[model samples]
Target: MSLDLPDLRTDLETLAEAHGITGAVVAFAAGDEVAEAATGVLNSRTGHPATTGSLFQIGSVAKAWTATLVMQLVDEGRLDLDQSAQSVLPGLALPDPVTIRQLLAHTGGFEGDVFVDTGRGDDAIEKLVALLGEVPRLSPPGAVWSYNNAGYVVLGRVVEVLRGVPYNQALRTHLIGPLGLTRTATSADEAILYSTAVGHAGGEPVPTWSLMRSNDPAGSSLAMTARDLLTFARAHLSDGAGVLPARLARMMREPQVTLPDLGRPSRWGLGWELQEWAGGTVVGHDGSTPGQAAVLKLVPEAGVAAVLLTNGGDPDPLVAELVAPVLSRIAGVVPPAPPTPPDPPLPFVVERYAGRYVSDVMAWEVAGDDEGRLWVTVTPLGAMAAHGGSQTFELVRLRQDTFVFAQARGGVHSAVAFLGEGERARYLHTGRLNVRRSL
Candidate 1:
């Protein structure tokens, strides 16, 4: 499926404009062109136009870079994929049985936490380790996928241990320096240096506040420009020929977990996400922080890849929307559409989990329905999507009556556990919550 590059450029401009995008950078491999482009403004406040080299916070896309670093350690025999993270960073005392692979794949059942707000490097790592001591597990290690940031925080520490240098230094020496990606760096310190796009929240602009750099092995903090990201994408798509060995590169993209049930276009590789695009897999991941979002995709077979970064939380969808059309032109075959799953039955006992649950941050009201569905109201006029049966609904394990949010996609969020005859409970968004039912 060879693509018409000219058509793609036209569509991208139109789409970005429609979405109020300030800037965009695109990279492609079409016929003779291993090309890149940037459009719109880099800093709306300064009135500077974005260029092909303009930097944007690549957000968690940095995880792939970190993952590649781990792969290097693997190749050098300094790290074992199956060893416990606790072993790598001893005296930290993380739960036993959580392998390094679980951290990379986010299956360690480490409940997500707010440690990223604590600033960067050692401080952030210490905060995460403390949170790990308090957060309840969602499931036994390796049993579930919860998108744990704690996992990546630990990975950052792993990088430090294996290299005997600060994680940032190793990243610079091995990744950024070797790749000639001058604009990229993994410093929380720099979060205050640039004239970055200010983030907005609740329709109001958030100040130019910075994020605490995370030491979790799972990706939390890293920054880069559009061109540097494109360079990274191309390297992966090309199997790291120049920057990393072909064997290690292949390992990075290989599927470590089968996530076919995570819905259409969803799969998980070592640290890379695998999604079906026009019958081929577009391997990449999406990132989000308070004020940023980014996506990086690569088509291995076609030798084409794309990197899209947005300064604001609401990113222009054109980054992902362009993949299929571009890949079809390049690959000559439309990837198969994602499949749909049969709806499950509504649970019989939805009343037990009804009523309002308040937390420090927000409040929620869970109301029961006669139709056997449970709806959660986070606002007066709007709800958090419908959850219940024959179509969609929450499920309770009949044997234990534990609450698990299930859909055709299985349980993407951590289950809200019910314990001791359902008298008390806690709301775990990505893992089990510690708060018992107060009502």
Candidate 2:
């Protein structure tokens, strides 16, 4: 499994160019053998080169780190996964009871995408948690699986209350510090001290460098080099080197809930996304920030792990081009092919899916024309509107209640699904669950 470092760097540069990736870091490990490579620029404006030690925004992948810290508390018998989230934080108001495990598994059911900038104080997460009372409960707790950013913030608060420290400090003290990751950055300010990659969009630098401090638990400001990311991944592979308990690490990879195939994970572990590849199982997570994206994939059965970090351009193809070969050679793993549209678009039962789905941050409408053509319109609202403007997508049936975007946008053929029965969709699932016509 030993790698030729020079060849890997050359190959990575070639693949990045092929995929239009402006800059990236690629790292892979097979037990004793490890190789890391970097290519392109940190910022298009500055033209700083991406290097082996360069940090890129890891985004929601920080959720995995947050979850690991929570698991450390669980390992010490300080917190029970089944305990109600409200019970841990005495005055925390929840519409319905939500368990610690529910928050970790994203089954907490409350409006989970509540990203508000409380401030740059240690009390930021506490402030965001206090505002959860105003957030509506989308579904009964533990009844569904939705990607919940707000839920992670709540988990961060749980860590804060239990560990008796701020969320960012707790992460460093527990996970980051314990793993001996010298290059991991807990905040954007800290990341700037290192050679950090700035996020870019459409081949240009993104105006904003970071999100609000309140969202730190959900990975708003965390950044790390690919090699450091691999080191963290290795902790799971090697029992956390006296930090994370082996049982908890194994438990994190154990499937807690099955997810509807929307072109990503097949199941959800405590904090990890579990994908079933042809070779075996790959437990991992993916991240996306303003203009940066990252992915951490691990094949524990093969004693193999890999990380891809990118700033700007089309990274999806770069991921496939760069990650698959190393994984395949080491573990005989094959990623599921990206879902493609049928040669002739298949017809769907319009009544089953045509409905308006609404959430606090985004609204979506599915409609069918007289010719039975399907279309989806999305409007970002309030705080979320700043990220993007409205856009319409043409969809073709993939299966019951599921449709794939007729064309790939941002190098992904995004899938959208409706949940319900008979004639009408009761919910819309595009990662986060949106209720039908519920405001």
Clash count of each predicted structure: 28, 0
**Per-residue lDDT for 256-363 in model 2, tens only?**
888866865588999999998888999888988898999999998888899999998877786676687778877789988788788787877787788788889999
Name the 10 consecutive residues with the lowest summed lDDT in model 2: 1-10
RMSD value for candidate 1: 6.8
Every model's TM-score: 0.76, 0.96
Q: What is the C-alpha RMSD of each candidate to the true structure, in Å?
A: 6.8, 1.6
Highest lDDT scorer: 2
Q: Per-residue lDDT tens digits of candidate 1, residues 35-88? A: 556666655566666566655666667778778888888888888998887877
Indicate the residue-level lDDT of 408 in model 2: 89
- For candidate 2, give the lDDT of residue 108: 91
